[model samples]
Structures are given as C-alpha cells and as structure tokens.
Target chain A: MGELRLMKGNEAIAEAAIRAGCDGYFGYPITPQSEILEYLMAEKPYEKTGMVVLQAESEVASINMVYGGAGAGKMVMTTSSSPGVSLMQEGISYIAGAELPALLVNINRGGPGLGTIQPSQADYWQSTKGGGHGDYHLLVLAPASVQEMSDFVKLGFDLAFKYRNPVIIHSDGAIGQMMEKVVLFDPIPRRTDDEIKKQCPWATVGKTPDRKRSIITSLELDPGKQEQVNLRLQAKYRKMEAEEVRYEEIACDDAEYIFVAFGTSARICQKSIELARAKGYKVGLFRPITLYPFPVNPLRELSTKIKGILVVEMNAGQMIEDVKLAVSCSLKVEHYGRFGGIIPTPEEVTENLISKVIGG
Target chain B: MTEEIIIAGFGGQGVLSMGKILAYSGVMQNKEVSWMPSYGPEMRGGTANVTVIISDERISSPILNAYDTAIILNQQSLDKFESKVKPGGMLIFDPNGITRLPARKDITIYSIAAADEAGKLGILKVFNMIVLGGFLKLKPLVAPEFIHKGLEKSLPARHHKLIPDNEKAIEVGKDLIQPFTPAD
Candidate 1:
C-alpha cells in the first residue's frame, strides 16, 4: 500500500536504510554489493535525513566506524560482499562482544577466498556460526526477494536495538543485482540525541551527573567476569532462538517430501515444488527467513510428516548441516547445491528431489 | 499468464535496458515482474544477458534455465541461448552479426534486421527499441500506452525527448520482423 517502485535488491536496501532513519552507514565498495553504497551516495541521504553515508578506505575501517557510531547510540550499519566482510571479522567480533546494536549486511558472493562475484549462500556457516570468534551469535535475516531486502533494514535495526545485539541481512549477489517490484514503507524520522539518550541509557553519551559513567569494551581481565559475559551472550542467543525463529511453509499440508532452502535458493525451490507437484509428487517448500535461530522446532515437526527433505543451497552444502541438526536425522535429508556462483535451476532442483529423495 | 524471457546481446547493444523496459511495462500493467541481469566483468565488452519474467501470479524464480522467448542480438548470445528456448517457444534475433542462424527446428524463429534498420533511421541507439517493438508485435504482452509509461518511468527525465523517437523505431521494428526460412 506504500510507494511501489522497481528497484534492485541493493538499491532497495540503501533506500530502506535511509527511510528507516538510520543514523549512519559506513561501508566499503565491493562487487555485487557496491550498489548499496553507490545508491546511498547518489541519493545523498545526509541531505534529506541527516544520515551520514561514508565510503571508508576499507571494510575494516568501515566496521570500526560502525563500532564508533553504535557506541554513541546511533542507528548505524555497513554492507559488503564476502571478501570485504572477511576483512571486518575482527571488528564484528569486537562489536558482538561489546554488545553494541549495529546492522550489518553481507550480500554474499561466491567464496572460500575471493571465489567469484556471483551469488552464493556459502556464508551461512560464517554468518550464523560466529565467523569472527567468541561465543557471540548474530541474528541473521536471509531475504529471498528485493522486497524483503528493503523490509529487513528496518527489521534488522529494530531487532538489533531490541536485543542490544548485531543483526545481519544475509543476502546474495543474485538478489542484490536482480530487480523486482517492491512496496517501500513510510519514512521514519531519525531519533534526536535526547531521544537516543533516553532510549539507550547504557550508551556512552558522556558523563552526566544523573547517571553512572558508561564504559564500552569487550575486555575482561578477570576470568570469572569473562565467563559470565559469555554466559549472558549464550542466554541472549537462546532467547532469540526461542522467540525469533521465522520460516515459511508452502503446500506442506500433504507433502511427502520437502525442500528446505533460504534466500535465492528458496525462490528456486518454490518453482521446483510447483514442477514436482505437476508431475504427481507431493512436494513442498520450507524457506527460512531468519537463518539463525534455525527454525528448528517447526522443521522438526514437519519432518515427522514428510518422508524426506532436500536441502538446496548455492553452496556445496553448508545450511544442510543446520538442516540435519534441526531434524535430528529423523528423515532422509539430502543436499543438492551449485558452488562457486552457479545457481541451480528449477528443473535441476526438481530432478534432484526426485532422484535423491523419491526415487533414490 | 506467465512469460519467461531472456534478452541477450553485447553489453552496448542495450540488451539489459530492453529487458528493463519490458519489466517496467509489466509493472505499469500491475503485473508481477522480475529482471535478473548477468553482471560483472563479462558485461564490460562481452555478452550481456538478462532473464525477465512477467506473470499474473507471483513469480517463484527469477533465474531460469529455459525461457518462453529469447530476444537475441549478437551471435555470441545466439550461440549461447538458442538451445535454451523451450520447444515450441519463440526465438527473435537481430541477425546482424550472427554467423550461424538458429538451427532449432522445434521453436519458432524470427529475425529482425534491427541494426540495419537503426542504421537507416540514423539513430543506432534505438536499435533495442526496434527489437522490443518486434517482440510486442508477436506477443503483445503489454499495451502501447503502458510502454510509453514504462519508457517514461525507466528512462531518465533527460531522455524524455527520445521517447517519441524510440516509439517510432518500435513501429518500424513491428514492420521489419519476418519469419526465418532456411534455404534448402
């Protein structure tokens, strides 16, 4: 019902960040995702909403800038591809350890090391399993469409602030570059400094007589305190797992087999389900909108009904591990993927489902 | 109804833009549409292609292996995508730089001398519009008014003056397209 426009996934993310009243965006340009920065620079949100859009020298500097902004209780974010995101791992770990609210977007490209500038979901492990280090977990939202790419900016920031944790919009090159119709939400005004101070009482907003001087750091010299911090982080992750598990089930009411996928792969499996059903196979699609939290309970319940599950991805098989863990190997779970930027087609997915699950 | 199409040609041949226009036109008609382009270094001077899907229902996948129609411009695209068209589908090409014609017997083949036509029109950039015009003639997926609106929406405001010229090229293209017949 809002403004409808045709936009690429990357452009939609940028526009959504601006409209979400994001206070700052510090990012480095990278292939497949440079459009996020390019669009921000072109739109000049600073002129409109007073949002600071900076092009840092590298991903490391950009993420550090995010740390600075987040510590000050500013709604801040940064986006990058796989290689660029790899450069920011240390910074990300520090932010997570510090419990700062920041939004990070990884428009994932093919990877192991600068693999390709094409779409891939290989970063599933790196994103959800704490790519940086420590016992921290980032709330990862995997958007399958350009529309969700726009919607998740606001949602990511909201969840980031809600849990005082970092949130990631884990997308891919295909969704980044692909154009689709999206209905944008109405613009929300950026919070004033006083509003931020009131909202984030723990933020390092300067020493005031009314409150204790806030210190922001991930370091704990004493082993006892560090263990407590790790325990607190684990508790928060468990809370997220219980409260924020988001997934979509299509035609699963009577399906004998299911395809579990996220992001671009989920969109492909939707079509594969249609094709499989046309050929008299009772197949369904289960798409995880939130990669973390894993959507384990619903999937486990569905596993009891379905005979098997085909875990499809753009990687050689990363999320498959999580899928297996979710179902506890109760049903035959198989993985079919195309790594290094190759996207599997609908026909290929359908054929794999038939051979790997039904016929095999 | 759903139409999955692939438009491929050299980077400068307006292959991506043509697909954008088609997608925008679909949007103008309040239809679900997606345009997924092949990006990166290969788009600089090499073959560039875009997969476009317009459907009355929600489109499931933007990346497809085969298409209902293929609008090809250069020979490289013809070589790569000729076999990717569905059997009994349609293949439309410029046939300007193509060395080997599409040899598929199952699909309908049509050639539009858009490059030569654009040369005669004294505006080479409108070559893609001519090809688009040829496509609309056969399929008529979108109406002319929506296309005018699509051109307005997709093209920058500075290029508004060129819409009439592009429309003229589309009209020229509608006339220039012909069914391909192989010589025995």
Candidate 2:
C-alpha cells in the first residue's frame, strides 16, 4: 500500500499524472487550476522522470504541443480552467479529428463569458458534447474527491489510448482547491515501452534512419475516407459505452428513492441519503464515475424499483438529461441542483427528496 | 456511530479548519470520514465553507442540501442558509457575526461569542476551534482525544504552540452549547 498524505486537488492531479507515466505536460496558467502548474514547476519531474513539462504562451500552444506529442503516440496531457478550456477547444477538435490519444483536465468555474471564479459544473455539455466542433466525443471522467482526482490521470490516459481518442478529467474548482488525505499509488504496473511504440506507430517523432516516415494529419479530401474515419471512431465510442461505463451504487437494493449525482456533489447527496433514511425513507445514491460512458443498464434496473430519481449536480442539471434518457420512464426522474456557483446542502436535498419523491 | 455537519463563514473565520479537526477526530477513531470545500474565488476571502461527513458506511455523494447541524460565523452565511437548516436542526452561530434569523422556531440555535472567547484566551484565531468544541459537545461525533490528535496532524509544525490554546477553545465552546439527542 502507498503512503497517505494531505494534498490539495491540484497537487494530487500533478502527482497522479506523473505516476500514470504521462510523457509530457504543456499548459498555460489559469485560475482554479494554477496550482497544477505550480506543482509541476516545483517537482520538475522532467529532470527525474524524463517527462517534458512546458509552460506555453497560451492554451492554444499548450494543446497544440499536446497534439504534436500525441501525433507521435506518446501519452500527453494538459490542464486548464473554464476560460482557458474554451480556448483549447480548437486543439481538442484537431486532436479528435486526427484520432490522437491524450488527456485533459478542466477545473471548471462559473461561466457564460468569464462569469465568475467560483466552482461550477456548467461545462457538462461543453465537455461531453465536444466543445470544439464537428461530430466528435471525449471520454469524460468526473471526480468528487481528492483520492479520485489522483486516480483519474491513470484512467483518462488509459481510456484515451485504449480508444485512440482524447479523454477529459472534468472537475470543479472545489475539487481543485480542496485539501484532503490521499493515498498515492507507488510503482504500479505500467504499460511497457514496446507496447507504447506498437500502439502509436503513426506518431510524428522523426523517422529513424531506416524507418518509414510517419504523418499525423487529420485532413482527408476524400469524403469516403472521412466517413470511414468517423465510423471507426463511432465504433470505438460504442464499445466504450457498452464496456467501460462505471458507477457506484449505495443502498439501492430496496431503495424507494435514488439521488443521482457526480463528482463533489455526490458526496453531499450521500449525506442526504443517510439523513432521509433516518426518517424511514429508503434512499440510495448512484454516482457516475464515467460521465461520457455513463453506466446505463444499472440505472435502468434501479429505475424499476425506485419511486423516483433525482439528478443533483453543481450545474443546472446537465447530467439530469442523461439519467432521464437512461431510465426511459421506468421511474419519475427530475433534477434539484445549484448553479452560478451556489451549492446545495444535504438538508435542502433531503427536503427535495421528501417533496418530490416521498410525496410523489 | 458518526455525525456530519457543515460550518460556514467568511474566509478569515477559519470554518475549514473547524471541519478538519472534526474529520481528523473521526478518522482517528477508525470511523470513515470525508471533508470537502467550496473552491474558486468564493474561497479567496469571501464565503469559505467546508462539509464534514463522517460515518460507519463508505460515504457517497459529499454534496448536501441540508445539514444535520451547522455553524454560522457571519451574517452572510446566516442569510444564506438559515432557511436551509433541517427542521429541529442544531445551529451554532457566533452572535457577533449574525444579527437576524428566520421566524420558524424548529432549530436549536446557539449564539456563541467564539471570537470574544478566543480574544479572552489570548488567541482570536482559535474562534473556529471553539466552534469545533461546540460541535463536539453538541454532537459528540467523536472523542475529545481524537480531536487533539487531529489538531496535531492539521496544524503546521510551527503553529504547534497554538494547539493547546485551540484545544482549550474547543473545551470552552463545547461547554457553552446545549446537549442534543445522543448518537446511538
């Protein structure tokens, strides 16, 4: 077992990326996520771990750098907050169009246009629906705790490489600044160098003396080729949807009401469950670990037993739509959440449960 | 048995540290616990708050809409959350920070002079410490010794001297709050 220590969400992010064997980090400084950069700057892992850490002129350059590294099939990642994430959308789409594999972390803040610097989950559509453009998707993983924050680096990169697509670690500022005790992994089994070389043959590291030239371009004038490319990516997404969807079920066996939430919001919903159960209500919580490959079958099954489903979040009920789509009317599903940087307490959630589920 | 609560106040009021002590005590007692904070600009010297949920079960969803109990250290928080308190919920407030309240009389509100208490103790910074003490007395969530250990772990090495004073503040805060239905 690894040693446990107190760390902030951003520090955990930095350490987890290093532990996950990410080959490089190219990012610009942004609020809420600046600590991620600070952490990397202090660690200087490039010197010891042989990882390249570059402070780019802007998010554009950083994500482009990621594209460059990823074009060669190396594990690369970048971090940014809301506004900076908006700027990187173009690069993200480019990476997706080229079928490059990489990871991105967005420490979300309230925004329509630089709205505020408070925590928010408003980027759900932006992240899950391909914030950039075109018919594309990214595997989005939402974490609620520092421990999970540390683990997502490994999960995001693995999924990205496994699917030959980009993956996103979408967290709020709350998760970034939070201080908690985290047990970091030590010497976990890693992908072998030979495996990486095989997986990324199209990577753009200059061709060796005798090796064939590799090109990592997304442009294809032939419509047939573009269609074929999209079909391949779609097939991979389907596979992830079927096989990689993940979640945690709490007390749902005989639950009358189930509260659905993700990331930091899920932790409080759990408390609401316990509080409601004390008053003789059978409440459960289903926390989605994978936002994109949302665990659907389990939700369908639970919907049959529960009286109602409440999708709570820090946004204006972004994931609620997914829950409703998954259950498909087996149960009454609604949303009770906070937005514009306001977070609901357990008591308010308990009241929502009572008024909506218990009363309904 | 375990208890959970949220403490909220302005940035300088030390609400997060109060939750830290409670969580520390809970973990030391071999109970499962988690403490989460609201991040971003709101925490930069504005309204800083923390959620401490300790239990025997593997805790899920740290987000909460209601609190079993809460501590309010400023007028803004009282205005923000007085209505959200659970029916018959326990609320502890620094009387100096809050100037008003809701008309409903279900909650048990304790108005403490934590800042003044700390001032008397020669360390006004321990105001949140008193709130933790109040939490311990009111909820009995964990033993006092666990809190002392937690304080030891949470405090910076250089701030070690203040631990005893903070503990004293906790003792004082606990003594001031009224009892509640004991945890089973």
**Leading candidate by DockQ:** 1
lDDT of 1 at B153: 93
- For model 2, residues A128-214, the per-residue Cα lDDT tens digits are 988998888999999888988998888888888888799999998877876666789884434456675666677665677745788
lDDT of 2 at B164: 84
lDDT of each prediction vs. the true structure? 0.94, 0.82
- In terms of docking quality, model 1 is high
Q: Write the per-residue lDDT of candidate 2 for residues B54-126, one digit (tens) a residue.
A: 8897665555666777888888887877776779787877777555643447877776677877777777878
Best by lDDT: 1
Candidate 1 Cα outliers beyond 4 Å, as residue runs: none
Which candidate leads the pack in TM-score?
Answer: 1
- Model 2 chain A lowest lDDT segment of ten: A187-196
RMSD of 2: 4.5
Can you give the lDDT of residue A150 in candidate 1? 96
